[model samples]
Target: MTPYDAAHSQGSNVLTDGFGRTVTYLRVSVTDRCDLRCVYCMSEHMTFLPKAEVLTLEELDRIASAFVGLGVKKLRITGGEPLVRKNVMGFIEGLSRHLRSGALQELTLTTNGTQLEQFARPLAEAGVRRINVSLDTLKPELFRRLTRGGEIARVLAGIDAAQAAGLKVKINAVALKDDNAAELPELIRWAHGRGLAVTLIETMPMGEIDADRTDQYLSLSALRAELESFWTLRELPLTTGGPARYVEVAETGGQLGFITPLSHNFCEACNRVRLTCTGTLHTCLGREDAADLRAVLRGGGSASDLVDAIRMAVDTKPKGHDFHIERTLPPAVARHMSTTGG
Candidate 1:
């Protein structure tokens, strides 16, 4: 078996989980509130979480610093809709200052890109290196039907603005049944022509999104098989055994990636942990989380205490996900992808 040297290791075993998965990536969810009412995340009668229940700016900073101190080298800021949150720029700027020495090598974000045009430039200036835009359809009518905002044009413009501001742009598409699945090649061509990295993600069966129909998720292996017919794929030397099936196209500009949790399970080599908007630290995406950082923060725990908590969380990583065993996750926890910081 191959081993990870943890190029970004801090000489401390605090970051490696029980299975020896050194956790260097941290996904921080800024808010659980999103304006869109997509069928996947929201039901018709869905209600947003209260503002008071969310983490404060100080809390967020403390948690982020704690993770950074514990050897997390990469962080991605996400949200239900981060742009909607007030003082987001200030928040990013604060994170930038704390990570001034560049110990945090990469800090980026994933957004619906609805408000990217307006905020893209400022975000780039505030130390965000990359931007991942979630776009499922090229047709405006279908975009509106699938996404609550119904604004495909704006998202397209946002991509342009982000690229103009010198941020590495990646197009993130969630292939859904009877929708954009058939259009993968077209999207790949478009992204390559525009010098954008393209990532196809499988539908995560969690919470409200899972309550209905999760059986429709297509596996990454199948997606790759379909792509190989059109493009000559050469392997790239990325972290091996990763969830994202990454390959370089012979003629395509940027590489192609697939995030597969169902058809190809990657929990055995999972090397990341997520901190939700509410300050809960989730060890894995497909399992019920047993540890949380919220209690420590609220209980006046020190940064050292936070570090110990993180180490303990890593020590308890599940043996593996139960996709093959047909084990179901807890219903209450699966309701919101935003809650998982995916």
Candidate 2:
């Protein structure tokens, strides 16, 4: 048995936060560099971290294995665009052993879909069953304006490639008042027609961008009320181990999800934590509390030490986040979502 398996054999290592919530999901950011600079996610001229500051691929594997051994059932690889990271596929393949051994129940990712065409087949072969692609708008010009030169055609092509590779594709659209509000219904229809699950997310208060986030914030509750005019949405009792709340649209016979971080607080059952590429562990997305695991890794800390650090971080997990958007105030968290892992 592997060292990870041996760690899992001890029942005392399971991670349970102070609120009695079990942490079974972990989002690991491989890199804070992306090919496209979405207005909300990052500044057009982003200053990325140095290569030495980020953990090595081997270190990433070691940290993630420690989490799996501590009872993390689902692992989602995220990034400023994870596909842009060199040798990321090899890292993902390395993690697939946990899935094969039943130590991890699910392994997946969230991407901008720009590189899906090149990596889709390899991802499926690496044991990824589903992936969430961030596509804000379908209009070519609007898409370019939103992403600062991202090609919608390329993203669409990548989506097609992912579906062809037998990976279940889900579209994640960050609902913006001025950007894609009108086009969302059409986007939903198109996605549902293609048998893809679409999730509408309220624009979050994260990072300092060129655009005013207060102006960009579109409440999912308001958007849902607007959709009710043309379509009947019935709330479904489904939890994907994420913050999204699902609903079934009667007209399209498709599933739609809403992630309302501002309009609604979906934090009572928070079971996930984010690990940045730099090895910072964020117990809550909207809060600033974090634990650095890179220090332990580089300081020659043992695997048991890594596990103890993770448990201590989980012990300090907050009940919820404090995310609010106002023109008068700064972002809830000073760090960018890219730095925090999507």
Q: Please count the clashing residue pairs in each candidate, in the order shown.
A: 4, 0
lDDT of each: 0.74, 0.92
lDDT of 1: 0.74
Residues 1-342, candidate 1, lDDT per residue (tens digit)? 111122322346348777777888888888877666566655645667788778876787777766776677777888877787887777787777635676677778888888899999899888887878888778888888777556788889999999899999878888675677787788888888999978887776666642344444566677788788877998877752236767788877578887876677777767777788788888877777767688888898855677788788878977676443133643435547866665
Name the weakest run of 10 consecutive residues (lDDT summed) in model 1.
Answer: 1-10
* Candidate that would win on lDDT: 2
Count steric clashes of candidate 1: 4
List, residue by residue over 72-186, the lDDT tens digit for candidate 2.
Answer: 9999999999999999999999899988888899999999999999999999999999999999888999999999999999999999999999999999999989889999999
Clashing pairs in 2: none
Error of 1 at 179 (Å): 0.9
